[model samples]
Target: MSQKIGILTSGGDSPGLNAAIRGVGKSARGAYGMEVIGFRDGFRGLVEDRTVTLGGGALSGILTLGGTILGTSRDKPHKMPVGGEVRDMTDAIVETYRRHQLDALVCLGGGGTQKNALQLHQKGLRVLTLPKTIDNDVAMTDTTFGFDTALGIATDAIDRLHSTAHSHHRIIVVEVMGHRAGWLTLGAGIAGGADVILIPEIPYSVQTVADAIQERVRSGKPFSIVAVAEGAVTRDEHTAMAAALQRRETASSKEERKKAKAWIQRLEEESTDHTLRLAHQLESLTDLEARVTILGHLQRGGTPSAADRLLSTRLGTACADLIEQGVGGVMVAARGEGVEAVPLEEVAGQKKLVPADHPWIDSARRVGTSFGD
Candidate 1:
């Protein structure tokens, strides 16, 4: 008998997930003649044994769909809400896997999904993952599937914001989505020709941003568009964050480490409306009217771009091929024009941050864009 394959999506929903699912399911069922089982709501569904058999009909015409067909959730295997309390359901998940006779489990998601898939891989089950995040911060891949669509949405928002900024002669601070990495903000900022761009990768100063706007005003440009990543922080805040992380990473005692970890989580939770605060600060410093427009979920809701569709299809088909061979513990990573199966160990729990000297940053600098550094 042919092997039975399982698939699930985890973490935040992204554009092109359906396309990836279709790519994998169609190939697995049609070409390789495998029985495809789709677990719903991520790891939670696996623990609860909720699934749908994905035949060719179920996978058809979903290439342009926006979300996963099997559905998705943020539940982790080790700590998901079971009844009223959190519980470790890894053994339950393994039981489900064994009961279903799955030859391999395919996971589609971002960085966190990769980590969770790694946990499953360690449990001695065959596992494969696909990179799927708008942040494009999954380590080892050229770019994740949803990033192109999100980037285009953010760029279009910035393009639209330019007209209002020009009309009001105001400093319009347009915040883009990116929790830790600034790929979305930086890309849209450059593409939209913003006067100033602030990203989380580089620490920035509000005063520097204000001074740049003032310079633009003196040079006959009355309006300024400041593109900021949601997670971008002031230089001083970045300094404190670095110190806290160092403490957490180098604590001499378990109690000290726990305290530092708590502090770090607190710092992250307090970052709400950071863009609004920056806008007000710039208004005071530059003596200009300032407005804030946060592009929140607008970035995450959209039709997948042509590039994203192509990438998802490519990675998805590659996943099916690997599953046919019973390969496991690897993420199907996009490398140049082709795909490569990277070991999950190299991808799990790792972040692909923008380097200081990345070409994108250099180009932005050479074109006279201010990073507010």
Candidate 2:
């Protein structure tokens, strides 16, 4: 009897998901002669016993597809929304797993998905994960699939915006998504040649950003482009946010925790409109017309780039190889030139953050980019 495996995509969808799926399905069926089935809408489908068989025809021609054919959702097994109320549906999922008799379950997602996969592993189910976030913030991996495609999209947007900024002599502030991490914004900013680059890793000052733009103006350049991460914060806001998070971590009572949560929520709400606020501040300080552009989901849509497709296929096939070797409870991490089966415990609940002294940061600084620090 050939080994049978199940696959699902969880959390946010990305450009290379389908390629990754195709890689796993094709390799499992051809190289290892293993049977494969996909769960729809992530863990929710497992709970509901929704599935699709991944035969040869099902895996064909998905190498350049953008999203997952199996679909995805943000639902967690332990606290999933069933009917109307939230319920622990882990038992239902385990029952379905037993019914299918899967030798291993492959999950493709980002940081949250890693944590959720770890939970399933603790329940005594064989689980493996593949990192697939545009943010590229999954811990223990050199780079995640979907990031290269999104980086190209973001860089192109910034490149196009430069024309209007230069023509109108305007300060253009472009926001890129990365949640709490700065990899996306930092890489795009450097690649796009933005004058001011801001990310969550480096708390910035509005005054410093203004000064940088003003200095460019004094140097006979009246227009400047600013690349900012959506989670980028002013120095003052960062200080307050850090203090609130500390309070939440050390809270002794429910009421204290509640207060801390509210404080953090308020800060996040304020941060949501940070791009517009930044443009306004820059206009006031530099006396230049300012514009804002948010490359929101635009970065997440499109066929996978060549780099992304290659990485997805690499990780996905490595996942199949690990499962064939009876490996369980690990993520198929991309090392420098090869892959590694990193234990899920090391990856879950951890985020890969850019170091302040990283070579990328130094290179950006050398090219006259200001981080507004």
Candidate 3:
């Protein structure tokens, strides 16, 4: 009998998910003569026992398509909503795995998915994972599969906004997605020629940004572009956040810890609209008409770019090879022009944040770009 492998895409959807599924399904069936099974809506499907058998026809003509066909969700195998309450669903999932007799389970998703996969592995299920977030924050991978496509999309949006910013002599604040890390915003801002690029890694100041805009105006440039990560906080906010986290970490009681955690979460939620406030601050300080354009989920949609498709296919094929060899508890990560399997323990709960002195930051600084530092 052929070896059996089950796969699922979890967490937020990205552009290259479909191509990845096609790559894994085709290669598993054709190259290794393995049986491919897909779980629907991530761990929820595994708990509810919903699945589909993959054949060659189902995997056809899907390389350029966007999103996952099997669908996805953020449900965790250990704690899932059941009967109107969150309950442990691991036993149910493990039973489903036994019924299907899968030799290996391949999970394709971002950081949270890696954590979930690690838990499943601890439950004695063989698990392999693929990095699939546009954030490119997954550690151990040179870059995630969906990041290239989203970067292109975000860069194009920034490129198209230059004309309006120039025409109206407006300071355009463009918000791109990146909460804990700034890879997406940094890449797009540099590629799009943003005048002031503010990232989460480098705390920014509204006054510093205004100064840069004023300097641009002094240089006969009437307009400016500020590409900011959604999570980019001002220096003041960053200090406040550090204090809040310290309070949380040092809380002596569970109640105090809970309150601190809630306060921190509220702060993060409020920070979601940071761009709008930034625009107003710029307008007030620079005396220029400032506008905020939030890219939001637009960066996650559309067809996968050529680079993303190639990356997903390569990772997918590598995943299949690993599955055939009974490899588990690892993530198929993209290295430089090659693929490698990194232990889930090393990947989970880790982030690949941009360093202060990264080459990209150096290049941006040398180009006379302002980081609002």
Candidate 4:
């Protein structure tokens, strides 16, 4: 009998999801002569046994589309809300998998999805994953598909903001999304030519940022632009987090560890309004009119860029090739101008954080970009 594969998108949606889906479905069906089906709305759909066949017509014309036709959700198979209560639904998902007799299952998503795929793999289901996130923080991969499109959108937004900042002679603080990683904010900050860029990798000082803006004002540049990552933290906050993490690591009892973990979580939750506070602080310190703009979810929408489409298609087809070769429990990672199958163990629960001494940071510094360090 011919092989059959299942596909699903999990977590937050990004721009190049459809391209990846088409690349996998078309290549699997047309090139490998295999049957392909997609689970709707991610793991919830799989638990409910909801599906859609990816035949000729369904796969056509989606290569340049923005989102997934199969839809997506952030539901986890092991901990899903069913019957008004959060319950373990892994067994139900496993039953659905067996009912469909899938030879392999492909999951397209970001960090959380990778970890979730690992759980399914441990359940003895043949599982593979693809990197898909605007954050670009997936480990063991050169880059994720949704990142390029998001970077373009963020850069364009910053470019447009420059005109208004210059006209009004004011400070504009722009927030970009990258949960606990600085790749997206750093890339867009440099590409957009922002005067000061702050990322989570480097804890920023408010006084340092104010000094940078004042220096620009002294140089006759009356307006300034600040690009900050959503996860970026003040130096004091970073220090406090480090201490809390240390406490968690050193805690002897489970109760103590749990308490430390909750403290860390609360600290992170409180930092959600950091960007707005940053604007107010800057205005007070620098005596300049400051404005804040939060690019929330705006970066996730829109069509995939040419580079993203190419990357998505490349990874998708490569996933088909691996499925044909009987590979499982791996992620189709993008290497330099090629693709590689990385073990799921190496990808799950890990993040590809931007290094302080990365070449991009050096280049940006050389071009007079201040990181507010």
Q: 1-373, model 4: which lDDT tens digit per residue?
A: 7799999999999999999999999999988899999999999999999999999999999878887899999999889999999999999988999999999999999999999999999999999999999999999999999999999999999999999999999999999998989999999999999999999999999999999999999999999999999999989999999999999999999999999999999998899899999999999999999999899899999899999999999999999999999999999999999999999999999999999899999999999998988
How far does residue 362 in candidate 2 sit from its true spot (Å)?
0.2
Please, what are the lDDT tens digits per residue for candidate 1 over residues 233-321?
99888988899999999999999999999989888877777888999899999889999998888888768999999999999999999
lDDT of model 2 at position 88: 94
| Candidate 1 residue pairs that clash | none
Please provide, for model 2 over 140-243, each residue's C-alpha lDDT reduced to its tens digit, 9 standing for 90 to 100.
99999999999999999999999999999999999999998999999999999999999999999999999999999899999999999998999999999999
Tens digit per residue, CA lDDT, model 3, 3-39: 9999999999998998899888999999999999999
The candidate 3 region of ten consecutive residues with least summed lDDT is 266-275
What TM-score would each prediction reach against the true structure?
Answer: 0.98, 0.99, 0.98, 0.98
Model 3 compared with the native: what TM-score?
Answer: 0.98
Clashing pairs in 2: none
In the order shown, the candidates' Cα RMSDs to the true structure are 1.1, 0.8, 0.9, 0.9
Please report how far candidate 3 places residue 57 from its true position, in Å.
0.8
Model 1: which ten-residue window has the lowest total lDDT? 265-274
- Candidate that scores best on lDDT: 4
lDDT (CA) for every model shown?
0.92, 0.94, 0.93, 0.95
